[model samples]
Target: MAARIDEEITFRKLEILLAFLEAGSLARAADALGVSAVSVHRALHSLETGTRCSLFRLEGRNLQPNDAAHALADVAREVLQTMAQGIRSTREIAGYAADRIRIGSLYSLTSGTVPALIMALRLRKPDIQTELVLGSNSELLRKLRDGELDATIMGQPEGTPDIESQLLFEDEIFFAAPAGSPYAAQSAIDLAQCSDERFVSLNEGYVTHDRFRDAFRVAGFEPNVVMTTNDIFSLMNLVGGSIGCTLLPGRIRSVLPRSVCLVPLLPAFQMRQKISVSFLRTRERDPNLLSLLAACRSHAAERPLASG
Candidate 1:
């Protein structure tokens, strides 16, 4: 005989069985559990198979549960409640029941703004533990909205309602070119002048990519495209290799290769990316979140280099 407790008798199946028992019909159970009627039937069938016993009897067009089914449903309900309580107790012990801050940030800020803000936050709250999530601007904003992250450091997200943001700093955009390129020797270059030059850029969904495209719009022409990459480092390497020129934030100059030059764009064509610390409005009163926001404000007031 198969074991009574086997992998087939999963927690999900148990939940389904309990729902089926309470609702008295597969269709009703499916509605209660937000699943298809067929899925409810399948889980009940699997449960009966795993237990190696008859759980239901087909009475005309309907399924009527036997004594065994009722007994198992009682046990399953108790088991689910116990498991839920165990999870809550574990979270309490792990300090997650309190205000544990989870901060999200741009991947590019990991080596710079993120570390500085973290260090400053720790200084203020030595006992506080933090979780840092890194992603693109859009991903971070979504996570923040879903409560997965308490706050995020990124370029200010536009058209997102119900988020509160504090401006951290403005980073100027520059035209990056090969060191030996003729344009590198000039103190500044016009974006229109590079209209015909092949360019390397970040793919869509990145804030920088949108900014790069907008710069071309200001210059009144489309950019000659060659390659698109995910990270700024790769884009910089492409420029260093003389493959193409690209636009990048001025702060990135601290890490650029000597073979790459970051030339300023003329004032008329200059673009600036505004970095901000953002959080859901609902989390505004959270002490840990407030502390983190204070740290960000302090860091920005110091006017530190974007390279950290």
Candidate 2:
């Protein structure tokens, strides 16, 4: 018997007990708790230890709560209600309960796609609050996996089995050159021709840099990467000042200055990177997750492609 019932009374364990009581079956209770049946069963044992009483009895096919459980139902309800209030109060204190939505995104997509989606989500749920966390693709994916994000907009789906991803749009990579530069007037340039030109690349950890390296391998040549920057904006500025040529999305043409020309790939080594929203597959049935997914899909359908 566990004597530290109060000490062991976690919100999750309490919720599990209450869910089992209300649902009358472990399967239904697990569904309500957003966990597997095994987890729910484990929680029941923990709950029993906390309460120091046999909560369930073995039946022919189904497990049924005993008298001790029925007696403890009132206490369980109070615990659950208190837990619910705590969540509500926390949300109120954060000011997020007032109709706000939080999102995450990769730095590359945050500039254009996120803003458009925020505005669009607002149209559907007016007065909705919005928060966007921007980071590298790996960082954003990590946050999404840890339950720290509602969903994330990033390039390429991660390899995590617990995550779910849906492609929203496609973007093509292109060559970026300063305006009025000799290369600006060209329709395209062969990778071999670019061998002698100084290149500005993303930092080694960046997915963009990895993609560029893969393309180089395909082109059968290594680039003269004289400069490296972590942010695309910095790389763009360097390219604008004629520091060096860099690879950029052709979609950026609308936002960039007319002086900078987006040259097509000569052999057209355009890589179609998928912009997607990722979330945990375990949370797929959650009401909040469902609402956010529908909102994201609806928003994606209404917004234009990353072109500009």
Candidate 3:
């Protein structure tokens, strides 16, 4: 037979035991835990009974803590502290709101949108700690679905009906090129005219990369991408160095290098990216998610999605 687990020993009793030992009297112990003296007395009595060992001695009219009681009190403090740490660790792993709130975002938003929203979140939840995970739209959506993230701010993903999202803004994709490129002088450039242009693009999962493919497909030809990178920043740097042309979101305009120019795509090739804060539909009522939604709504109010 399996050994019987001790059910009598519990956190409440241990807490009372610690208080009773340190406070020197039942009344003081009760006051420490905001309970009545009788409750403290009963809890200590139960704890001693549960230990199955002599932890107190009857001295005339009062019970005095024995050496064992003192030692057990130390253990009790350690147990409480260790349990507290364990709880925090579990919550962090689950990305639940305990000590930290984990947020996911697309690399494109890092320049401005993500930063502004984080500041807004801090104002509403000053005590809550934040952890940010940046990745592509596909990657962030996967993480959010898998419970690894508390919320995500990105170009709203497609076909993910399970996610609850708050629309923050909409952004248009722009054709990017070297600042000195002749395309900079045009009011709009047809992708067909740049069919021979060498391009540097972000990897497959990025919203920008996916949108690039869609836009090129609409233009009725495949882009001659000379290079592909996992990040948007490097792709932009390549554009700045004239390595090749690329596509970028309008939101990225604030951080684009002076050596690069973002030009409008002709009507046929234009794709609007709807940026949003997404979380599990079930987690809509979570305090952290609610705060995040409020922050996004506030951001949307101050900076509406650009009109094409």
Best by TM-score: 3
Q: How many residue pairs of model 3 clash at the backbone?
A: 0
The best-first sequence of candidates by lDDT reads 3, 1, 2
Minimum summed lDDT over a 10-residue window in model 2 is located at 92-101
Model 2 C-alpha lDDT per residue in residues 1-308, reported as the tens digit of each score: 85444555577777788889899899999998889999988888877887777889989878798888777777878878888888887765443343555577766766567777776666666766777887777777777767577677777665678888866777778888898788877887676667888889888655677778877777778888889987887888888888888888755555676657777777646555667777778757644445566766886677555542
**Candidates sorted by TM-score, best first:** 3, 2, 1
Model 2, runs deviating above 4 Å: 1-77, 86-101, 124-128, 303-308
lDDT of 3 by residue, 1-308 (tens): 99874788899899899888888888888888999998987887787778888888888866689999999899999999999899878866766566568999988788788889989999999988888999988888888888888889887777877988899988999999999999889888899888889999999888888889999889888889899998888899999998999889888888889999999999998988888999998887777778888898999999867732
Q: Per-residue lDDT of 1-308 in model 1, one digit per residue for the tens?
A: 97357778999999998888889899999999999999999999998889989999999989899999999988988999999999877754433434366888876677678889989988878887788887778778888877687789989988867998988888888889999999889999988877679898988867788889989999999898899987788888999999899998876766789999988899888888888999877667766777888998899889943421
Clashing pairs in 2: 99-129, 100-129, 101-129, 179-259
lDDT of 1 at 287: 67
Clash counts for the predictions, in order: 0, 4, 0
Give the Å error, residue 253, model 1: 1.9
Q: What is candidate 2's CA lDDT for residue 12? A: 75
